[model samples]
Target: MTAKLADKYGPWGVVAGGSDGVGAAFAHRIAAAGINVVLVARRVPVLEACADEIRAEHGVDVRTVALDLSASDAVARLVDATADVEVGLFVYNAGADDISVPFLDKDVDTHLSLVRRNCGAVLEAAYRFGGPMVERERGGVVLVTSGAAWAGGASLAAYGATKAFDLVLAESLWAEWRGHNVDVLSLVLGMTDTPSLRRTLAAKGDAAPDGIATPDDVAETALRHLGDGPTWIHGAGDPTGPSPLGALPRRDAVLAMSRSWAEE
Candidate 1:
């Protein structure tokens, strides 16, 4: 499987937000599969630590880029950083809102920054990294989204919107690139036990609920089903099935989501 992955989407892989949690999991798995990895994240210390671990454990080259994806030139900088290598896999996994307050409670700039990071940067990464993959006729792209994207919720306004955008973008790209041998997957996650989620829950003086997915499990599942594109819902009974809220009326779905947030 490792050899197959390397031969098909090998040489190098880029994981934005590849410091800890799901991003780091992806980096480790990719490296273990014999692919050199370029790990991009905001914290220099955490990024370096993760890179070093991958290098030691997997015996594969690992590069670290301490970059904030919200920056306007992030994708351009990433392209320049990896200009010498052929990145056959690109995973944008950085969008996670640490706050879960109502829309009006958060400042305008904060929401805008989230939009920049989650939506704009993701789109740009897909364009820049995915284009090269299409040109070469072999590569995979995974856009890590959230189940919040299924409907609008009380405290997930900006976050949900951005993830919805990612979901659509990945599915659309899959439609256009499947014939070109470029796989695109929108990995929709539910509650995951990541540092980001922990912080969010901590801020509310709460702990993670039972049965939340783990980063390593999520990463492994996504990588194994790279070609089962369009969409993949982690932890769902039917991974490739319709949304859990598919049969609900739109208004009821929104209300249901809002109630969940209120309970949280």
Candidate 2:
């Protein structure tokens, strides 16, 4: 499966927010599958370290591009950084909500930042990267999103909204690009055990959260199932089935989601 992915969407893969957690795991796994990787992140040291590690472990070429995805010119910078490489895969994996407070509790700027990065940047990335893939006739894209997108919940207003955007975007792209041989996946996730998740949990005063998914398993599963998407819900009983709350009334769903946030 790995070798096939490499050959079909081979040469290079770009991972936005590729420095740590699920993004980092995706980089390593992609590299292992014989694809050279270009890792982008705001943290230079961590990005370079991840690149170096992937190069050493997978014996594949690796490059690091240090840039904040939330920056206004980030997508342009990313396009420039990888202009020389024949990048065939892209993973927009950086939309982590470090603070899960009530909507009004957070500053408006922070909400805007999330919107820019999660929706605006992701859309631009698809336009830029997917353009080349369409012309070349093969590629893959994974947009990592969350279950928070399924419904509105207290403390999840902006964050969940952006994730919902990603979910819709990925599915729409898959519909448009399927016949063109460009695979697009909306990779939906639950609470995963990752550095970013741990930090958020600790910040929220929870030292350890039970039932967290492992990053390695999550990445491996996504990589192995890249072809089976529009939406692929990780650890789901039915990855392609309707949302778990799809049957519930909107009010009930919202209330249930609100309670879940309280538990978190």
Predicted model with the maximum lDDT: 1
Among all windows of ten consecutive residues in candidate 2, which has the lowest summed lDDT? 204-213
Which 10-residue window in model 1 sums to the lowest lDDT?
Answer: 1-10
TM per candidate: 0.98, 0.98
Per-residue lDDT tens digits for candidate 1, residues 1-264, read 678789889999999999999999999999999999999999898999899899999999998888889999998999999999999999999999988888999999999999999999999999999999999899999999988999998988999999999999999999999999999999999889988889999998999998889999999999999999899999999999999888999999999999987887
Error of 2 at 96 (Å): 0.7
lDDT of each: 0.94, 0.92
For every candidate in turn, the CA RMSD to the true structure comes to 0.8, 0.9
Q: State, as a TM-score between 0 and 1, how close model 1 is to the true structure.
A: 0.98
- Please give the lDDT score for candidate 1: 0.94
Per-residue lDDT over 24-93 for candidate 2, one digit per residue giving the tens place of the 0 to 100 score: 9999999999999999988788888888899889999898888888888999999998999999999999
| Count of clashes, each model | 0, 0
